[model samples]
Target: MKVACTEKSQILGSKVAKTLGLPLVYSQFKAFPDGELYLKTGALDGETLLVSSTADNQSLVQLLLMIDACDRSEITLVLPYMGYARQDKRFNDGEPISSRAVARALSAGVSRVITINIHEPSVLSHFRAPAIDITLAPEMARWVASLGCDEPIILAPDKGAVIFASEIAKHGGWEYDHLSKTRLSGEEVRIAPSSVDAKGRDIVITDDIISTGGTLATAAGMLKDGGARSVHAACVHGVFASGGFARLAAAGLASIAASDTIESAASSYTAAGMIAEAMRE
Candidate 1:
């Protein structure tokens, strides 16, 4: 199998290729004067692992183009971060199921698909081809353990993320719990954990995706108010959509860390090894 990666995931792709003892294929990408994307791939045959993180519309287009360029090759897409996954359901009339649409588009050119810590696992059902959802919680836990905090505790921003928190805690052998969240608005939320007694404990809030960071900010503030010694945040996909990193910093979080799914400054760990192992399976 050969490995090829979109520009956004070059760093991670190289790592995965090295682990699998596969050669990394080079692809050229550029943009026209009017901002249209152009992509060309080198020779690829047999089973090929195409690694890409659809962080935005442009990267999605790039992946599609690359898939089309790899003529007749069996393509297995590795989407470290599947964008538009949050819109998996129709909340109102006339709303589009964005995740399904994206899945269909992706399935059109790939034999199988793999994603890391998608917002909704149900979204994988939309793909016509076989789809796999991999978790980065173990990688996150390993990174957290490297921090070497005296009294580390893993916290989920809301009940929905309890499983993720628990996985990290289990891997790190730390205490784990979840917060109750009340969404006041798109950019506002109220988070609390009945009685964590966070006093003097170093807390790490873990989640699958951190978009606006509102939930993390609120939870971190609450922990600090409860006398927590320090609060940090970790996630698989750190979208940081609207100044989220700044918002978390303003909320007094000691640091923000995430997997290299989106290639941001907060990416303290790489999901390459995990993805490589999944591909082997």
Candidate 2:
């Protein structure tokens, strides 16, 4: 009945603690002047939940430590955001599958795993333990509705994001569609819908993760070009690396929001309630 979490995921840990009616463990961690980490926490059980996020490389290391410390009991790791999943495959002869490395590290520590909106689901097989993937569809829909956007239209950045966008639209009783993506280069791409009229729709563009904001910005640009009145962006994990959000806004995105998977500045949502509910089964 104990709960623990990494620093990047404190935002999610807070909500999960509230929903589960449990207290968060007293864990103290600090970084040395040279940037080394020091951590200490109270006693724990085998039946514990470790809430974590993929905000940075450190969070992953912290999670591994927490899992090892909880050897006295079984552990369930809840990662609101999963990084490295995009590198699930070795596209080149000398390329390393970072996603598999991450999964292996995590599996060695915890007994089971949980995550939301992984960029590549196949990465789950890299883990030695069982893993579950959750979505923020119901939660995202509720928030968009709360924003008072009447019958919103959920737009996917690309085909990969259609499943998430469709679920959001389904929950909100809205319509959804995926824009097309044409990669111009390894780092450059273009996006536009094949056929859709979005002249006056309140569009909410969504995806699994927002890494460099290239896909989203490109997609939003196309929607607006096609007469979309307004374009907002949402995602389960907002990496926003190298000023991705700034780029998205510069490309004319109305707003940028994400769940507190990483310690990003735009984490306007939490998945604790959703995760707790899903775990009840």
Candidate 3:
């Protein structure tokens, strides 16, 4: 099978193709004056590996178009960063589950689906095809290991992400904890490492997605104020919506990085190796 990709995931798709020693199909993308998306991929007949990161509406539509373009090929879809996954639940009446909607749309004509650190694993149930999710904790562990920090602490922003943090910490036998909050008053709250003092310790706050920098940025300041030597941030998808990275930097975070799931200046690591390994098996 040959590898193909939407425009947004060209770099990552290329890496995965190279790792697996598969021929990468060339593609051309265009936009008309009326804002219609256009794409054409090299001839594909049998099996195909289609990689795409649907980070926004345009990318999502492009993915649908690319899938349709491979009508005769059996496609294995890879969504490295799936948008709208956090909206797995419908809170109000007359509201649709956005995650389910997107999943159903993409599942059409696909043989199987693979995702990386999807915000909610439960969302997989909405897909029409067999779906599997992968994590980048191993990659995160390796990246932090190269930082040469003294037994750095791996911290999840909240309890919800503790499992992911634990996975990363175990790789190096490092300490792991979740940020705990205490209410001093209606106007003031305190956040710090739970069950452990962060004093003079290097801390890495990690999560699956970093959409807005509000929480992490706020926690960074408090972690430093709590006497932590330094604070850093890492994640699987760095959506970094609206000055997220700048906010983290302004909060005094020593560094901020993410996987190439969504190519950006801060994508200091890669998910290609893991994707290739999974595909090989």
Candidate 4:
């Protein structure tokens, strides 16, 4: 089997292909004057590992096109970052479950699906094909270790992320805790470690996604104000929307990094190794 990718995931697709000791399928992409997408693949074998991060509408359409292009081949689809996954539920009466829509649409042509830290695992069941999700906690932990932090404590910005934080912290036997909010007064509020002392300790905030970085940025400043020596941020998907990275840096984050799942300036790590292993298994 050969490896192929949509336009947006070329860098990560290449890395996965190399790690798996497979050839990278040459693909050319362009946009027509009317704003339609175009793509041409060199060649595809009977089985293909197709890597694509649907980070936007165009990328999603492109992935469908690529799957059709590999019509004769069995495809193992990899979605490093699923764009519409956050809309997993329909809150209003007339609303559609967008995650289900996208999943069913994409599952039509692929034999199996793989996702990295997907926003909602339930969406996987929406796919007609067998689907699985993988974690980048080990990669994130390694990246945190490379930071040379002084006994840094891994922190989850909220309770929902405590499990992920613990996974990262266990790699280095670091203490882990979730941030807690307290109402100091009618107009005052405070955010700090739930049970651990942040004073004189380095901290790393970890999560699956960092969309606007608003919560993390605010937490970073608060942690610093609470006497934490340093605060950093890390995640599996760095969806730094609306100048999120800049916001985190400006909020006094000592450092910020994320996995290549979303391919941004802050992608200090890659999920290729994990992906390759999953494919082999």
- lDDT (10s digit) by residue, model 4, range 1-281: 99999988999999999999999999999999999999999778699999999998999999999999999999999999998999999999999999999999999879999999998899999999999999998999998899898999999989988999999999999999999999999998899999999999999999999989998888898889989999999999888989998999899898989888878778899999999999989
lDDT over C-alpha atoms for residue 203 of model 1: 90
Candidate scoring better on lDDT of 2 and 3: 3
In order of lDDT, best first, we have 3, 4, 1, 2
Off by over 4 Å in 1: 181-190
Q: Give the TM-score of candidate 3.
A: 0.99
The 10 consecutive residues of candidate 1 with the worst lDDT sum are: 188-197
- What is the C-alpha local distance difference test score of each model? 0.88, 0.81, 0.95, 0.92
In model 4, the runs with Cα more than 4 Å from the true position are none
Q: Candidates ranked by TM-score, best first?
A: 3, 4, 1, 2
CA displacement after TM-score superposition, residue 4 of candidate 3 (Å)? 0.4
**Judged by lDDT against the true structure, how good is candidate 4?**
0.92
Structural similarity to truth (TM-score) of each candidate: 0.94, 0.91, 0.99, 0.98
Estimate the Cα RMSD of every predicted model relative to the unseen true structure: 2.7, 2.9, 0.7, 0.8
lDDT of 2 by residue, 104-175 (tens): 888875778887877788888888899878878887887777777767788887776788888888886788
Q: Model 3 over residues 1-281: C-alpha lDDT tens digits?
A: 99999999999999999999999999999998999999999999899999999998889999999999998999999999999998999899998999999999999999999999999999999999999999899999999998899989999999999999999999999999999999999999999989888999999999999988899999999989889998989999999999998888899899999999999999999999999888978
Worst 10 residues of 4 by lDDT: 258-267
Candidate 4, 148: how far from true, in Å?
1.0
As for model 3, its CA RMSD to the true structure in angstroms is 0.7
